[model samples]
Target: MKRDVADFWNLLWEATLGLCALFALLNLFAPPQDLPWVPLDLNRPIGSATGTKVAAFDIARTAAPDQVEATTEACMAALRGADVQVERAEDTDDGGFCQVRGAVRITGGDVTPLSPSVVMTCPLAVRYVLWDRQVLRPAATEVMGSDVARVDNLGTYSCRRVYGSVDASARPSEHARANALDVAGLTLEDGRKVTLLGDWDGAGPAGGDGAVLLKRLRDGACRVFSTVLTPDYNDAHKDHFHLDAASYRLCATGPSRTRRAAADSESG
Candidate 1:
């Protein structure tokens, strides 16, 4: 009886030791399981200009001070004369993109007319031309008829390559870096919706407003962005407008009267 009791205790000890070893090994080699989720709430309003929050995983852990300052300045400029309140700034790498997240409030716009609402995420150092400058400001003054609201986006921050290239599959895209944006359509405060793919060629109910607005926006984009691709350029951009800050020569391949004239003269 004494021998059996001793043997049983020894076996229990050995099993406990083995279980501890197994747990350690699993911890050392297993991938992390507590991945964080990115915040997508863009509707919250910020009350202060400077504050701090736990940095999101999508932001870089380390960012150059100049880069951060440039991004902040660009965002402020985009807001124009609106009262902007920046809540917090942090660097993180959440969605495989180098990004910065801070809450912002944009005031003084005609549509919605809210005060100090939160802006979720914007590209760093990439200045965004307001929807007015991109679409409405360029539209025929007569066509707008004094309706102020305009613009729609097809989401941003994609992880794929430029048009999904496999060979020479370079680093991730500008959207991944928060350096690119895609504009899809526009809407007026009077409830008119103008889409890029659907209404760009007078296919919507806006009576050619969509086509006119898209052309104007693309033309302005060529002036603002180093790389601008649109539906008229090729099949790769059949659905949306691609705008990026790459340092390449400005190429306006969209349906521009200036481009057509230049082509005609070169051919003539």
Candidate 2:
């Protein structure tokens, strides 16, 4: 009986060691992006954890303000490593609702230029470039049969409350801190301009290539931006795609729920 017990224990130990070895082998061979615990690298292809990693930096701004600087530097380093051209913006605090930190103006870097140049927080910039390279450009080529030359924007940073509420007690918007981007239209290589207002659902959902391209961009944006408010959200957003990396966890694809959580984080 003692020999039998000893044999069973030895078998169990061997099985445990084998499992550990298998996992180690898998981790060694897997792509960096495929691993959730792997640190985010802009140079790498977008993986399943890319969105969560990007969102974490914005959340860190509120949850642990002290860590913001370090995260921002790390994020910028990742961008530089990827050969993205960016210039640091001067930090500013309005002594009131608006404050900009770890922000940068994205210039030419294998990315489509933004019309009427705008600055964005580093995290959002990362998402922007990724969306441009991985999602936007490819989608445009596939659907529009043209390369994207420039992206028309409403703006990036504006010190204001949510929905531009005039009341002092109102929750501040992500734009109050250069953390949001309002994309209105896109200019194609073939000189075709597509605007959300005119083309989003312009052809009965999927009739025209223009409408299809808009829908594709919107869907791809949802994958990266923590909060993406589109025309389907409300009349106010009827003209542009509101993409932001705010702490609020919302996609606003069809107005499923109003975001109250952002009010708390936007207080910073």
Candidate 3:
């Protein structure tokens, strides 16, 4: 009986130690960007589209083709479930890696409408909704004390190479595959406009509502987008936040280098 009790205690201690090790590793190797630190406003009203949905897990880039197709379906269903208004777009293969397997053009969500409708892969659209619902609206309310009425997207899909890369032979950009978006500004319910051009960094930081709102937006975008390039990232991105669902991750913020050409072009 003593031996049995001793064995039980040993197992218990081992379990505790294992848990501690896991937590320690999590603390050590966790991503530098943690969005959960900023809580969302659950009280904010959402639109009514209909259907129940489950949370999504990332579809691995190295997954089997079958898994990729199924994940695409699941993401589409999840968007409909969440009540995001999406229209299926035709398959686009601009050769190379610039193919859009399952693209969509989003019109609106439950309570919000995307102005100058953005188009992209269904998965990318779903990510947009996640950011809009989880971060954008709440962040707006938290920082500016107003609800977002319209989102002015710079755009999503564009048949072009990487925007700010100096290499002429650089690979096709996520925009080419409809896997990215460029956000221009947000219009609040109170008729206030929060934009990247008029607000980013010192331009908006002093006593400007646009700057504070832009800061919140940039941080929130970092949480949702795998690669978030801002006015701080490069001159080509000074007027818009370039967000993408790339396999790799990036979160950079700083003054952008000046460009001789206009940054509004999709390939800028």
Candidate 4:
């Protein structure tokens, strides 16, 4: 009986030590089965047109072929749904910018090319603020009382990192990775030029239309993108509206003084 009791205690001790060893091994070498840091927004329903399917993940640094096809389809579909005419679609490796295209006039004018900056892995997270100027036509007509024309691009695919004291080591900008775009200006059919730096704050002849249209565009962008930064947001965004798929929050800023208050809250 004494021997049996001693044997039982020995077995219990071994079991406890085994459990401790197992936990230590798990902590040291095992890959996590669940990720608590990455939060997914499943609110947007997945939809695709006949030719392509919607991407399952955000457009990141590396993109799969199917992801590219899906994102291209989504962008084209959005343009088409807004009645924009796509002149042509071409693939280009302009510093990680994929699938550059020339989308012609849907707002009644000569053909113009629309170059989009789309990233690979994060297909939904694009770097440019693309507008189907066809969609902007009615808004421009209603707001500015004129026939709107072309949407201009400042530049796309710059191989630089984010500005300010963010990070160093020369990481690619959203544009370089085809995740961001910069809009320098726009030209109308009536010979009106609305440049971002020149006309954003009612400074040029196209100021009124530019301001109104930019506001509307920013608002619209918030609905599609997870993050939208406009001229009124901060000095860092004094020129163009920065739109991206951040997956956490949506921000829309306008010319109103209230924009400052909104920015404070957004950053917090």
Candidate 5:
């Protein structure tokens, strides 16, 4: 009888130990998230999100409905002031104002024929020209020793969530609203291609100026666009620079120069 009781207790102890180990492994691999660690009453208001508002496009000031309309007018006026020449595309009868409002066909800028003459929102078209004038040309001249022929872009508008991410709760991407542009890289008048894939670290021979150009251009964009996502942001942005006039200035902090240096050191 005594031996049987001892065996039963030993089995129970081993089972409990196994359960504890399993729980630890699960915690290490997939800790629970999206749960209220602090319990709250369901009936009470949980209020707004909590975090530091660091993005440049974000504003602490809230706008009334009337103010929103007025602000839209002001932004259009600013686009005109920038001399962003655009032709109005025929408005589609789509029941929503989102597709028609501020939509324009960008013909060209100081350069000429924005390649495909993409149809996008006036705000984005205007900002693209601004970036070309203020950031792209100078960055090229300073770093690449040539005038930029044209700013090569992937496109401006898409009607989907970010990268078509499967996250159901993810907010609509700025691309969905025609409020963003993806810059593939710059084109020099001499026909040399400066791509993020090949030249972001610096172009030319090792320690050459082309390599540094990518970093300077990225830093310049931080002051020009609300959100300037670079390769530093993630692998998703490794091929091109994503720029937007969204409500936040999210310029990834590190440059490709530092990235390459770290990689070289690790391998060495």
Candidate 6:
């Protein structure tokens, strides 16, 4: 009995070692986004380690002052390596809870330009570029039968608590620190306009091409952004998609009961 138990333990140990070796070998050829230890590359496709790595950038806002600068530098390095142009904005404190640190205004270079440009945190900017490249562009071509020309956004920085919150003690929104983007519309190369309020439900019950394209964009945002609030989330969000790179993650598409009934009712 003792020999049998010893043999079982030995086999398990050897198997674990073998699996670890295989994993390491595979990771050698995998993209940087797939390897946890590897630094993040904004140009790479989203992979196993992408979420965790991107989340690390949020430390720029949530960590100590020293760490915030370090995290900001690392994030900017990733963006620069991806050939994205950025101009760092001076840090600002509103004399209250809202403060913007290590924020940047994406200037130009290998990125889709935003309409009425606004400044944003490094993490948010990185995720926006990724979303534009990997999600919005592809979905537009595949579903809308056109390429995206410009992304129209409502705004970025607002020194206020969460919208509709009556409590003065309510947590400050990501916008308060320029860590969020309120995506309002997309103008396609073919000159068609798609807006969250108009095309969220699409043209039919099963949804038309516009609805499919919008949903795809939403789903793609969820993969890269830590927080994604769609119109289905509530009336307050009925006109735009709220995407953010906060420390916490939440994909608030809608209520559970409604979701259970029609799973395809909303965005990411």
Give each model's whole-structure lDDT: 0.51, 0.81, 0.68, 0.49, 0.60, 0.83
- Candidate 2 C-alpha lDDT tens digits along 51-165: 7777655634353455766777777777777788787777667998798888788777767789978888898998998888878899999998899999999998898999889
User: What lDDT would candidate 2 get against the real structure?
Assistant: 0.81
- Which regions in candidate 3 have their CA more than 4 angstroms from the true location? 1-69, 164-168, 202-207, 255-268
RMSD of 4: 13.2
Ranking by lDDT: 6, 2, 3, 5, 1, 4
Q: Stretches of candidate 4 above 4 Å error?
A: 1-130, 133-135, 164-166, 169-172, 207-209, 246-268
**59-140 in candidate 6: lDDT tens per residue?**
5435688887787888888888889988777777888878998788888888888988889998889899899888988888
Q: Residues 1-268, candidate 4: write the lDDT tens digits.
A: 9999999999999999999998777657643312222222222221122112222334434667676566566654444543444322344465432333221122322223333322222333222212333234555666666664555655444455656223555544545444444555556667776666676777677757677776666665655555667666667776776755444564856554456687888999
Tens-digit lDDT track of model 1 for 84-167: 333343333566444434323334443322112223344322223333433445463446554545445564455566666654
The best-first sequence of candidates by TM-score reads 6, 2, 3, 5, 1, 4
Most TM-score-accurate candidate: 6
Q: What would the TM-scores of all predictions be?
A: 0.54, 0.81, 0.68, 0.51, 0.61, 0.82
Error of 6 at 213 (Å): 0.6
Model 1 ranges off by over 4 Å: 1-91, 94-126, 138-141, 146-150, 166-168, 255-268
Candidate 5 runs further than 4 Å off:
1-83, 90-100, 109-113, 203-207, 255-268
Better candidate by lDDT, 5 or 6: 6
Candidate 3 lDDT tens digits, 65-92: 5775676677776677667666767767
Q: Model 5, range 1-268, lDDT digits (tens) per residue? A: 9999999999999999999897777556642321222221111221111011112112123445455345445544544544545565543223332242445676543433455456665556545655566666777887777887766778876666787876767776777666777877767887887777666555433235666777777876776567888877777787788988777668886655567678989999
The TM-score, computed over Cα atoms with residue i paired to residue i, of candidate 2 is 0.81
Best by lDDT: 6
